[model samples]
Target: MRKFPFLLTVATIPAAIPAAATAQPVQSLDQVEETVLADDADDADDADATGEVEAITVTATGLFTRIENTGQAVTVIGRDEIEAVQGADITRVLARAPGVAFSRNGPPGAFTGVRVRGGEAEQLLVLIDGVRVADPASPSGGFDFGTLTTGTVGKIDLLRGSNSTIWGSDAIAGVLDISTRGRSGLAGSVEYGARDTLFASATGGLSEDAYFAGLAASFFRTDGFSSAAAGTEADGSEQFTLGGSVFVDLTDQLELFANTRYANSDIDIDGFPAPSYTLGDTSETQETEQLSGALGLAYYGQDLTLRASYALADTARDNFDPALGAAPLFTSDGNSQNLSLRGEYRLIGGLTLAFGGNREWSEYQTDSDTGEDATITGAYVQAGWVLGGLAAHVGARVDDHDRFGSATSFGGDVSYRVGGGWRLRASVGEGFKAPTLYQLYSPYGNLDLQPEQSTSADFGVEHGVRGSDFHAALTLFRRDSENLIGFDNATFTYANIARARAQGIEAELGVDLAPSLRLAGVYSLVDTENRETDNELARRPRHSATLFADWQTPLGLVIGGDLRLVGDSFDNAANTVRLEGYEVFDLRASYPFGDGVELFGRVENVFDEEYQTAAGYGSPGRGAFLGVRAQM
Candidate 1:
């Protein structure tokens, strides 16, 4: 495979461009979620220590918008929340969101799948910085969350429901946008946990008026438990991660920025023997490497803002089995490159016009399967309006694929303030997912397969207590999907042979009981069925909820706890195999010690409930971890 030249180009952009601008501090979790509804009457009295109204730019909308003005069901997870949870992986952190669910095959570092609103894993799009990270080699063209670590990630924006009008294919469910840390400072952490798990990370950077640069690195290793329920042999994994960003202000209104992240992991796995589906004594090892990065230039004018970016996501995997001799089992590589240009211009009063274009190239190679490549080009336009207490957004996109011809998607959302601290919103959108290269060119592929399409709608209401710290929201959503691709048992070939219907309700509440205490919770009820067979879709729970509380003491001590509940679901399409429901509890504590230092500890799965997200797979039991962090 040829090396990607764009990465090297991105690394050199900062050095080439000079910079000048006032340094902006990182946004806090609450500030990042600030609503568009301003409290003019209380602004003077409610000023922060800095005496400035807290606000942030939300990127989930393609065109940046204020959080409160965003008509979609969006959730923001900041660095503070990430640190408070003490999660070992990204999946654990994401599971706390309202309409998100995940199933892991085994221990950490194993193949993991995440679903949004009862949609399949592949239907959801994952983005880091601005680059799509789906793996073309995977059967579903989905990203494996097991490889994502929380150490370098600074913020996450989860947009639930169909967003293909703004984003493109594979956004039938939603989009997970992750932004890495880019603040100037020095920080590091070291941790040790059960099963001989060890983790360490360090980050440092400089964000001054002239230029900004940030870099972070992390290492993790663990002697994990068995992957299968019947296996005793330990399956361990190790990972190394490096990420960084650089920005240079060429002028007051123009800037150049580049960001990159690379991760490499080796995992020991268990496999089934000849006839049984249970774990056997066979030993296998898989190595995976992923590199993603983006380079962009932005211009902020008086009434117009423009950005152009080039990004790439590359992944490679190789497997080996000692029991099958020294030779390798199989190897695969996948790559996707994207170039995009977007701009926003102030139109008439209270209105903005947004437009963008994107071109993406995807390629896949495997030792056993056929190698193929494809390209896609798309363009989109949107209109955004904000007047008094009403906000509205409408967008449309047209995509041309090399193999599948063309597809068009459109969406619109409206929100209106009903009364004091109350708002009502409604949205309707359409999405589509094109067939992957493997589904079209491989041996089991069907060249005549059509793209999967979906139509979704949602209605929601939100209320925030005036002059208080309480907020609540309720949303009901429905999705109708057709031409779903699945494998046929009788013919042993891939084909588009299914349709699905999914509907769900999501509710969330947050309260600040006191200056030192906070509480939050979310609940979701989903109903998904296969339209062809009238059977419940596999691996989708009907009910799920999470509750969390945190408190800070005068002595610089912080304490928190989380309770997660996952309802029952089926493991197969026939609905004959049942997976029982389960609940898990976790506790965390942290105390500031010397200057710029803190000590923290957490206990996960306190009761050690035995549960399986996937049939025959083992979930982690009760475990404890301790760590310390320092910053300068």
Candidate 2:
């Protein structure tokens, strides 16, 4: 179910641009409300002409823009692919994309970090329903993918490379945009699998000519495997999440909306026990709760579009050790209050102006230290031109931090149709990641730390016919970073002393073998170096690839399978410990009955492979699961 990516060239715009990307007010209520998801039906003017639904994407440059209108390397995964995996982990879905790598500390619910284009995990900016969800309490301020289960999420969009000019800070690596179900429908799924695993999720929404509302919830629990490679005790994990969105049209040209999400998780963790001082089972546990929401209003005018939002993200965590008593060994709390304002104005002669401003105040407190806070104010503006046979955009941003002063960034991209069905794309961008509150004010923190900075460039070409199901793209990218933050063993503190470079090739293609069969493949070749020590960065495989195939039978049965290949990589910064590469295969199938219900099942790790992306961590073995899904 790959979306068959396309690289639109400037030559394709001899005609006018799509209204969905313009400032004109839209008439379709669903189109207006679904903007919460970063995409809308009015996406472009080509949808009606082609009679095929057009997939859209949002940009930091301006209002929600059409995918074909941008030059960034972007990947889109819809609900169909999520269900095809039939798994609860989101990292599994993300691994299928190019230029992406991840390392999990242990099993599900453990800490997981995703790295893009040689950039550290903490450099990526993640947005859920437009809320920046990174945990400021973390040492590096990175989101844990292991805690992100595939629940009511209906769409995922990944932008690879630096986009700081588009989103301010925290975009040195890239950006991951996730959206929950936004369409009008009733859907649910229940599954029971190995290790006493249970997963259940439900989503429902109602949409009218003037309003749209939706709710979704999911629960997951597993009597998991031992996290320690040498331990025999089983660690368990449990999680619950609930989210909802509401949109009401105040007028034909104005809309009001609210979005919120809540999650709670408890996980049993293994620790390095005394005496042996090695990873082993211990009486340790962690409990965490997260709440994020936003209230906003959007105005759609004949020549200008404006949006305003007030959002907050709050997280609290507690860790307990039996040896230290049941009162809890440690605790921490983090919160971010944000104000966002953005607009896009369409001018005459195929010119558009995109601008945005943001203000954020973040605070973090732990039992070990007093609470600390910081504020950041930023603004950016970009102009796009759709001339007869050329398309391009250039933007600049300025961000000022209460403690760290100011930093400025600039970026631009272009696309041109060279003729035939081929298009050429190229982009150069600058990005930066500010030091987290914990990094600056903690007991081991360093006030002298500066923001990590990066400069990235990518060039590629793609070939695909608009009406055809066949598509292919190849890109070459490189990124050089400075002032990267890392723990200094000698100083026993965090410092900005690392310099690095990451360069690689990404190739992807999708096609239909038959009317009922589809195949897709993505391959990445990444080369990374620490520069300081001349060693490859840990846990990033030099080569990786994924293959996907799906078949639809005449009897209405849908069968799908995917294979993953990873090359060897080091598990430690000094390259003293090696982690062998491994292969894992998975298969899933679903059959529709009547009454909007379907039965499905899946097998994971068909070969029961033994391998680890992180040393001393255990990987999942063969497992099976069965489930039923309902749609109404």
Candidate 3:
């Protein structure tokens, strides 16, 4: 691979180049779902102190949009939800989402990824504060969800289905956009909990209008659970994160904001060789750190709003395997850098248009066998329109790589009111995932693999209860994929299979029940398989459901609990490892003494049932955690 520093000259296309025939066409929308926020008018007491959940904002569409009106299947996890769940990692927070699967190789904050709609881990795109965070050096080209801690997270938006037209490559499955809030004046937390877990966080805002600057930092350490095998117990890790942002009110109509976050984590690893199934003292260790920064300007007026941003990310990793009696010394280093600029505009009468482009440069340098350098450049454009009781959305993207020629993706969706407080929505889209550097340039072989692509269709209907705080919805979806990437069993070489597919239905119901109590239930059923191989997809449960309830009493206490259930599923494409179904429970309680302080505690894995959601792995058993929070 070659560096393209001067390639910018070729990248400049005279500004008048004709659009390619394959250039995607733009579309718009009419009706959108109204968002139901935590700060809704009905809950005056809950909205008084901590600001209602409705006050929370989301950047799900690469632009700021209220959660409910996003015109997509979007789920938001706000600060209250984050704190109540006692979730230490992204996997636990997103586990309730339909068609989403997560697994980890070690303890909390370890190597982990999310699989969507039976797609491989690499097919999902992960973002932090609107910046893409996928690791270019990953063997499978996916973002490692394990690196992010829940301490700094303000909210998370999980958008299901193909989003390639809005995002770009690696969005064949969907997107998980994470947003963290900047520290405000005099706000911080110091907490320690059960299971050897220690955590501390602080955020402070400076200047009036909170427009000058702010800082947030957190540190975490935990001892992990292990299998019965030796060398697998007590293998834990630690992490530290520091983030800062500056917001300048350039003018009344325009604001300039810049922010950056850096995270450093160290993990302890245990590897075992096959045949004996005995643990070896390999003493593997890994250190990872990532830096992300973005600067943007926004202008808003009565009828027009415009915004633009430039973002950059640089990440690196170092992995080491200590020398053993027979095992040779092994070490590897990998890094990647990316730069992107995007723009969005709002036109007359609820019409919005958006466009953006990004260039990414990545490299892997190591003494180990696999090493390479690669470059990828991608661009996209989108438009949305809305009218009374109707909404439409469409977009397209193109990715040109130095190795592969180019790939294009597009999608469109629409929603309409069906009367009687009922709504119907449908969408069709195409998404693509490019081959990673390891798959294309690794010394192990197979440099001729093609990119994977998929087409998806979805339909959903929702209804609201008249004069009551109750709602329900049912969604059906199907996806067809081509050039799916996999490895050959005989030679261990990367290859593209002919096809794969997933069909599923998800239903959700929520009720206020009463002023102090709320209840929600979700059920999901999926049939996912590989068409070419005639086998079940790996690590995808056919049936899953969740029950969650939150209640507050006159005793000044808030309590909540949730249950998650997953049915049996195969572990591999060959259908060899059959994982049994299991259910887990969690509980949380919190209360405030009105002195700007609160005490909170959570019990996870309440049943302590021992089961493996992943093949040949061990998950954390029943655990308890308690912490205190203070605000001023």
Could you give candidate 3's per-residue lDDT for residues 1-632 as a string of tens digits? Answer: 01110111111110100111001211110000011212244434643542233322233355544333345665666666676666466676777566777767657766786887677787888777666777766677777777888877766777777877767777888877776655445555666665688877776666554245667778888877552224445667788888776766565555566767899988776667566755543466678888887766655443334445666666677766665443434444556556666655556566767677877777765566657877778888777776767777788888887877788988887877778657787888888887887777666447778889999888888664211356677889898999987776677888885698998998888777878898877788888988987898888888888888889989979999989888998877789989889898988888886887888787888988777766656677777777777877
Name the 10 consecutive residues with the lowest summed lDDT in model 3: 13-22
Q: Give lDDT tens digits, candidate 2, residues 1-632.
A: 01101101100101113343444444433343344223434433433443223545553343455555567777778787888888798877887789888888777888788988778888999887768888888878878776678986777878898989978789998988777665567789999998999999998777666666778899999988888877888888999999888877788767677888999999989999899899999989999899998887777666676778899998889999987898988999889999988776777776888888999999999999888999999999888876654668899999999988898989998877776556788888999999999889888889988899999999988765222356678999999999999888899988998999999999988777877898888899999999999999988899999888889999999999989999999988899999999998988899998988999999989899998878998878899999999988
Please, what are the lDDT tens digits per residue for candidate 1 over residues 1-632?
Answer: 00111112223221111100001211221121121122332443564321323222243457545445666777777777888888567876887788888998788888889999999999998888767999988877999888878888777878888888888989999888777765557888989999999988888786655467778888889999888877888888899989888877687667677889999989988887778755654589999999999888876565566778899999999999988888879999999999888876666567777788999999999998669999999998888887877888899999999998999999988878888667898888899999998888888888888889999999999875211367688999999999999998877788999999999899988777887998888899999999999999999999999998889988879999999999999999999999999999998999999898989999999999999988888889999999999988
TM-score of each: 0.91, 0.93, 0.86
Quick one: RMSD of model 3? Answer: 7.9
State each candidate's clash count.
1, 0, 17
Better of 2 and 3 by TM-score: 2
Candidate 1 stretches with Cα past 4 Å from truth are 1-60, 275-277, 464-468
In model 2, which runs have C-alpha deviations exceeding 4 angstroms? 1-53, 59-62, 465-468
* Lowest lDDT 10-residue stretch of candidate 2: 4-13
Q: Top TM-score: which candidate number?
A: 2
List the candidate numbers ranked by TM-score, top first: 2, 1, 3
TM-score, prediction 2: 0.93
